[model samples]
Each structure stands twice: as structure tokens, then as C-alpha cells.
Target: MDWSQVNWQPQIGDPHFMGWVTVLVYLGCAILAFKLSLNATHCFKQHIQKQRTFWGVVAFITLLLAINKQLDLQSLLTEIARTLAKEQDWYDKRRKLQRIFVIAVAFTGSTTALLLALYYRKIIMINALALLGICFVIAFVVIRAASFHHMDHLLNQYIAGVRLNWAFELIGLALISANAIRRLNKNTRHRASVD
Candidate 1:
């Protein structure tokens, strides 16, 4: 059944809403992380001076990427549906875009990780979590695209792979959160001691 046929007034639960939920989750994580990271800008600037170019670029790009996702994902998703909603080759275009986005995210995320690992010294945990977050973001993008193409009532291998990858990424994010809290407490203790 075409989505148009669904009753709009009463609002039936479209399992397809899960795709939207996943996107929301990705955006939420980005926003929360971005805000927390932004709050540390002064510290990053002062402490990260030795690797200024790399760290500066990473911070800038991370902020830009998060803002872009907040603004761009919805419009892009609509554009995608309009262009490839009924096409048989929809998966091809999606695959191409997914690969491109994955590479971009991986590069940006890895660069951020490198900067923290090199400059911040104490954020080994944050860097590790950010890497995992990048992996999850890639999976999130791929899985959404897969759901879009799954309209043909067909089973695709990549969709399954993405779901499996997403599961592992959850574990990574949990570790990152734990480590971040630990690091925050440690920093707090050191600051108090100095005072």
C-alpha cells in the first residue's frame, strides 16, 4: 500500500516511523555532544595550542557537521524521497550517497579523535567514544536509506549489515558515556586540589 493511502486524520502507526525515530536519535546525540563540546572551547583553545591547526579545524568541523545535520537531514530526506521514491534504481543512488557520507563522517570523526588523542591527552575516552559515535552515525545514515529502499518488499543484505553494526555501536556509546563521566570527575578533583 502506498503511504498516501494511510489515513492522515487519525494517525495510524506506521512502522516506517522507526526510520524517522532513528534520524531523530542521531540528531539528538549530535546536538547534545556539540553543546557539551562547545562549552569546552576556551579550554581547547588554550590547552590545544601546540596542535592548533588540527584541533582548531576539528572543533570547527565538528560544530559545522552537527549544525549541518540539524538543518540538512530533513530537507535532504524529503528531496531523496521526491527523487527516488518509486524508482527501481533508488538503492543505487542511495548506496552512492551513503558511501560518500560515510567517508566524510569517518574522516571528520577520525580527525577529531586524532586531535584529542594528541592534544588533549586526557580525553582518550572521549576520542574513543567519538569514534564509536561516528561508526553509529554511519550506520544510522545507511539504515535510514535502507528502509527507504525496502519499499519493494525485498530483503537486502546491506540493510541487515547496518542493523548488526548499529547494535555494536550502542555498546561503544555506553562505554564512551561512562568514560566521559569518569574523566569529568577526575578533572573536577584536580581543579579543586589546585584551588
Candidate 2:
């Protein structure tokens, strides 16, 4: 229980092939979302400000997720909590604590999403696909955070030699990218029509 004896080095949660692929996908999605946000900024169209806010949030979230994908910062959080539980003589009650933590995370995430959707209702209708993608990403994070043994095992399993986690994460990134490309194209066409 000595804090000095504990290893404080940073660890790579997923250093294998599929992990890097997931990171790349996250970066790609972030770039696309950032581009979409910039497009909104340079436009004079209706709801431009709303679109900017939505895409800006998406870009920022994806960028942070990209960094987290490789760094596995969440593991550090888990480790800290574990240490605290042991020090407090409540390590045996960690299961209950973890359950409560996961439920709280789920509730907070769901409430935040609902509030955002309501606040950006018009933009949500326009970028519903990206919103869906965001939900998928959020769900993946929550599930991962839960760190349930069976769920973790399932996510770690190989699907046609590709990690299942990669599939789940990439699917969400693909949706966001697809929406960004679609909106950018639509904007281009709109400018053409205007000219």
C-alpha cells in the first residue's frame, strides 16, 4: 500500500496492429469534423452557427479520443481508484463502487447528449448521422469504462483477424466522416447554384 512502491510509468493499453488502426481512424475522423466546422464558419447559410458548434464539438471530442485511444489514460484513472479503495480499506467493496460509477457515467452521458440534442435541435436534424456516430462513440467509451470482464473479452476478440473494438470504434468514425463529406459536398453545390 506504499505509494512510493507503485510503478508510475505510463502504459500502452493497446500496442498491437488493430490499436494503431483505431487511432488513425480517430485522427481521420477528427480532421474531417474539423474541416466541416471550418466550412460552417466560412458560410453565410442559415443555421451556420449551430452547425459550427456541433461540428466543433465533434472535432474536439474525436481529437481527444484519438489521443486517449493510444495513451489509455483511463487505465490511470482506474489504477488511482483502485489504490484509493485499498488505502481506504474498501477494496472488497470495489465491485459495488464500480457498478455505481458506471451507472453514474451512463446517466451523465445520456443526459448531456439529450441536452445537446435539444439545444441544437435544428442542427441535429441536419447532421443526424454524425450525431448517431457520436452516440456510438459515447457508448463504446462507457462500455469500455465499465471494464466488465466478459464485455472486455468480447471486445478484445478477433473478427476476421481484426479486433472487435476496432470495428465498433471505426464504424462510428466512418459515420462521422461520411457525414462531413456529404455536408461539404452539399455546400459546394450550394455555392455553385448561388453563383
Candidate 3:
């Protein structure tokens, strides 16, 4: 068990290259989300308040996620947990705190998604609900792997380009991007026709 040999930051494919590539992709998605928010507010006149609020929230969330990915917030939390456990002289408390944090985040995210879905029964909102579902599934898989001491194998598979979580996250981003672009284009065409 040579800890030095363990790749702490195992990413999909080439570790060095893929990490930057994924970060860039996430940044692009965040930019797209911001653009969509702007278009929704300025270009679309109908349902102005609702459209702006929805897109604005989406943009904020996307940007936050992009930043979180870039910063590796989970690792930071892990470090914090380790420090706390060391100070308290409790070995297992780190894992307990980490689990609590994960559960809290998942619960908050799901509740937010459910509220949004109920408020807006549009296709995009439905897609958001689906994205939330995928997130829950991914979390469940990761928790199961960790509980069974199979996380190393799962992470190895992820590094080998079988990253289900990343795939689902990208899919969710794509769905939001597509929906925004479609609405923007439709509004633009309608405006042109009316002019």
C-alpha cells in the first residue's frame, strides 16, 4: 500500500490534459448559461419576469458548479474534515462529517429541483428534474462504491474514460444550453417576422 503511487487526482483519460479540457468545457457551459440569461431578459418580452428569473438562476447555478469543479471543493472539504477529526481525536468523525455534508447537499439540491419543477411545468424544467434525478443516481452509485470499499475500482474505471458522473453532468449542461439557444432563436425569428 504505497500511498505515493496512488493518483489522488485521477481524471478521465490523460490526467493532465483531460482535467484542463473538462474545466474549459465547464467554463464554456457557464458562459453559455450567462448568455442565455441575458437573452431571456432582453430579447424575450413575454413572461419577462419569469424568464429572467429562471435563466438567471440557471446561470448562477452553472457558474457555481463550474467554479466548484475547478476548485475541487470536495477535496477541500475532505481536508477540513481531516483537520477537524485530528483536533477532536476522533478517527471516524471525518467520514461521518463528509457523509453528513454529502447528504445535506443532495437533499438541498433535490428540494430545490422539486420546487422549480412544481413552479414551472415547462420542458426545460422537466429536463432539470431529470438532471437532478441523474445527480441522485450518481451520488447513490458513489456512496455504494465507497461503502463497499470499491471506490478505488470505480475511480480507476473513471480514469479509464468510463466516467458516468461526468457524462451525466455534461448531458445536463447540454440540455440547458440547447433549451436556451432554442428559445433565443425562436424569439429572434418572431421579432424579425413582426418587424
Cα displacement (angstroms), candidate 2, residue 97, comes to 1.5
Instruction: Tell me each candidate's TM-score.
Output: 0.42, 0.89, 0.67
Total residue pair clashes for candidate 2? 0
Residue 48 of model 3 has an lDDT of 63
Candidate 3 residues 45-150, lDDT tens each?
5556566667676666666665656565545445454555566688566567556766776787678667776765544442364345335434543353234234
- Position 98, candidate 3: lDDT: 54
Top candidate on TM-score is 2
Misplaced by over 4 Å in model 2 are: 1-8, 41-46
Q: What's the CA error at residue 11 for candidate 2, in Å?
A: 4.3
lDDT comparison, 1 vs 3, better candidate: 3
Q: lDDT of each model, Cα atoms only? A: 0.46, 0.82, 0.56
Better of 2 and 3 by lDDT: 2
lDDT of candidate 2 vs native? 0.82
The 10 consecutive residues of candidate 3 with the worst lDDT sum are 5-14
Query: What are the per-residue Cα lDDT tens digits for candidate 2 across 72-165?
Result: 8766666676777788899898878778987888898889889988998867776888988988897897778666778899998997987888
Worst 10 residues of 2 by lDDT: 1-10
